[model samples]
Target: MINRPETRDLLAEARQVLLDSLVPELGGERKYEALMIANAMGMAIREQEQQEAGEPESTDVMLSRFLAGHALPEESEQGEQTLARALRERVVDGSDRELRAVLRAMTETRLKVNNPGYLK
Candidate 1:
C-alpha cells in the first residue's frame, strides 16, 4: 500500500503554500519570480499526476508530432529554418485545415502547461 502524501499532491500543496504565504510578502521583481516558481511547481504537479495515471506518449513527443505532422523535418539547422518558413507561409495562407487543427491542439497543450487558468 502507498503511504500518505503522494508526490503530485505534495507538489500542489507546496505550490499553494508559496502562493498563500510567501508570495504576498514579496514585491516588485521578486514577486514575479515567486509567481514563476509557483507556476513551475503547478506544471510539475500536473506532469506527475499525468504520468501516474498512465498517460502514454509524453507531452514533448506529442507536441513535436503536432508541430511537424507525420513527416519530421530533415535533421539540421537549415532544415529547421526551412520548416519554420513553410509553417509561417501555411499559417498566413490558412489553406491547410489539418495543420490548423494540429496547431490549435498544440497551442492548447502549451497553454495548459504555461497557464492552465487560461483554458478555463
Candidate 2:
C-alpha cells in the first residue's frame, strides 16, 4: 500500500509555495492572478479541513435533499438541473420562506469557505 498527503495538505503546500516563491517573482497582472490562485487554494484547503472535521453535508447536498422532500410530481427525477430550476422558481416566486432560509444558510456557508473575511 502507498501513502500520500491528504488533499488539504497538498493544497496548503501549494499555496505556501505560491505565496513564498512564485508571488515574489511575479508582477503586474501575473502577480494578481497568482495571488488569486493561491487564495482559491486556501479556500479549498479550508473546505477540505471542514469535511475532515465531520462538518455537515455540503450546501448542494442539503439543497438536493430539501428539494427531494418537497418535490412536485413532475420533479420525481430530482436531478441537479431540475433542482436548480426548482430553486430558481422558488426564489422568483418569493413564497417559500423555508427555501429562503435555506438559501441564506447556504450563502453563509459558502462565504465561510470562500471569504471568511467578508463575514468578519
Candidate 3:
C-alpha cells in the first residue's frame, strides 16, 4: 500500500517533468498539455491496486477502495458521473505519488480501450 508521502513525491516529480521537459517541447500547445494530463489521470487509477486482500468492509474501505461500496448503488443510480467526480476530487486533493501513478496507469488503460488517436 502507498503511504501519503510517497504519492506527494511522485506528483512533485511528474509536475517537474511536465514543466521542464514536456511543455517546452510541445511549444506551449494544449495537445502536449493533454498528454501530461492524460498521464496524470492514469496514475490516479493505479492507486486502487494497493489495497489489502480479504479485508472486511468499512468506511475507510468505502472511501479508499475504488471498487468497494459500489454494490450498494443501483445500476440506474450509478454511472460514470459518480466515479468521475470521485476520481476528480481524489486526484486533486491527494498529494501522494503512488496515487498519481495509479492515475497515470488508469489514463493509459483508458487510452488502450478507446483513444481518438487509434480511430481508423
Candidate 4:
C-alpha cells in the first residue's frame, strides 16, 4: 500500500512529489514524463468520478485489467481510460520535445496547487 501522508488536504500534494522527484528521472529521459502526466490527470479524473459515484469501490477491476499489460492499451471501448489512451497517444504522437512539455506542465501545475509549504 502507498504510505501517503495522512495530513494531505488534496491529491495535488501527491502530484507535486511525483513531479519533483519522479517525473524528471523517469525512463532515463523525458520519454516517460508525458505518460506520467497523462496518468496523473487520469487519476485526478478518476477521483472526481468516484466522488460522483458515491461509495464507489476502490478496486476498480476494469482499470486493473487495463494496467495488466506489457504496455497500456490504445483507447478501449470499455471506457475513456487514461493509461491506455496515453500509451496509444505516445505510440502515435510522442517526441522528446512534446514529452518535455507535458512533464513541465504537470510539474508546474502540481507545484501551483493549493497545498502547504514548498512543493518538494
Candidate 5:
C-alpha cells in the first residue's frame, strides 16, 4: 500500500495551486487552458479517490459480466481488446436489451466520475 498524501491528495493540491495562484495571474486563452487543465486534474482526483475507496471501474465490472455471461475464456487470454470488440459489435447490431442496459450503466458510471454535474 502507498503512504499518506496519496495520488488524489497530490492531484488536489496541484489543482488547488493552479486555481488559486496561476489562474488569478493568467488571462484570456492562457486562463482558459489552465482552467481546463485544472478540470482534468479534478477528474483524475475523483477517479483516484474512487479507486482508493475500493470501487471498481464500470468498464471492468461490465466486461467481466459480459465474459461470464457468454462463457468466454479467462480475461488473461481474450483480454480487454477482444472483449471491447465484442461489445462494439453488440452496440452496432443494436439488438440486445442486455447489452443496451450494460452500456447505459457504463455511461452513467463514467458520467459520475468525469462529470457528475451532468447527472443533476
Candidate 6:
C-alpha cells in the first residue's frame, strides 16, 4: 500500500529538487542563498531521521559524557546546579591541552547538526 509522505521525506524531496533544478537555474547571490537554504533543509531532514531512528536528538549525550568525567555529587536540585557550575568552571580553568580537546569535541558536535561546511 502507498503511504502518505512524511514531513521529513517531503523536505528531503524539496531539497533534492532545489539542488538538482532550482540551483542550476540561478547564479551569483541568489544561487548562494538557495544553497544556504538547501543546506539548512538538509540538516533538518537528517536530524529528523536521526531522531526517528533512536539516535540522539542533540549533543547532550557528548556533553553528559564529558561532565560524567567528574564525580556527580548528591542528587538534588541544588546539587545538580552545583555540579553543572563545577563542570563549567573546570572546562574554563582546565589546561590549554585539556580545554582544547573538550572544546573541539563540543564545536564538532554542534557543527554536525548546524553548519558542517568548515569540515569540507
Model 4's alpha-carbon lDDT is 0.49
Better of 2 and 3 by TM-score: 2
Q: TM-scores, in order shown?
A: 0.60, 0.68, 0.25, 0.24, 0.71, 0.58
TM-score of 5: 0.71
Whole-model Cα lDDT of every candidate shown, in order: 0.67, 0.74, 0.48, 0.49, 0.75, 0.69
Candidate 5, superposed: residue stretches over 4 Å from native: 1-3, 57-59, 71-80, 87-95
Q: What is the overall TM-score of model 4 with all chains considered together?
A: 0.24
Ranking of predictions according to TM-score = 5, 2, 1, 6, 3, 4
Count clashing residue pairs per candidate.
0, 0, 26, 0, 0, 0
In model 5, where is the ten-residue run with the lowest total lDDT?
A: 90-99
Write model 4 residue lDDT over 13-52, tens digit each, in one string.
6666667777766775464765567456546654554446
lDDT of 6: 0.69
Q: What is candidate 6's lDDT per residue for 1-120, written digit by digit as tens? A: 898989998999999999999999999999999999999998998677666764452344444544455554435544335445775777335554543565666566556667768767
Residues 9-108 of candidate 5 have per-residue lDDT tens digits of 7898999999999999999999999999999998888777777765555566776686678765555555466556665666334566766776677676
In candidate 1, clashing pairs total 0
Error of 6 at 40 (Å): 0.3
For residues 67-117, what per-residue lDDT tens digits would candidate 3 score against the true structure?
344332324544344445656766333554544554555554445434525
As a whole number from 0 to 100, the lDDT of residue 60 in candidate 5 is 66
| Residue 117 alpha-carbon offset, candidate 4, angstroms | 28
- Best-to-worst lDDT order: 5, 2, 6, 1, 4, 3
Over all chains combined, what TM-score does candidate 1 have? 0.60
Best by TM-score: 5
Cα lDDT tens digits, model 1, 59-120, are 44544554466464546644335446666666433556655654565566667666779999
> How do the residues 8-119 of candidate 2 rate in per-residue lDDT, one tens digit apiece?
8888998999999999999999999999999989989878876776553666566666666675333555444565676566633446776676677677777878888998
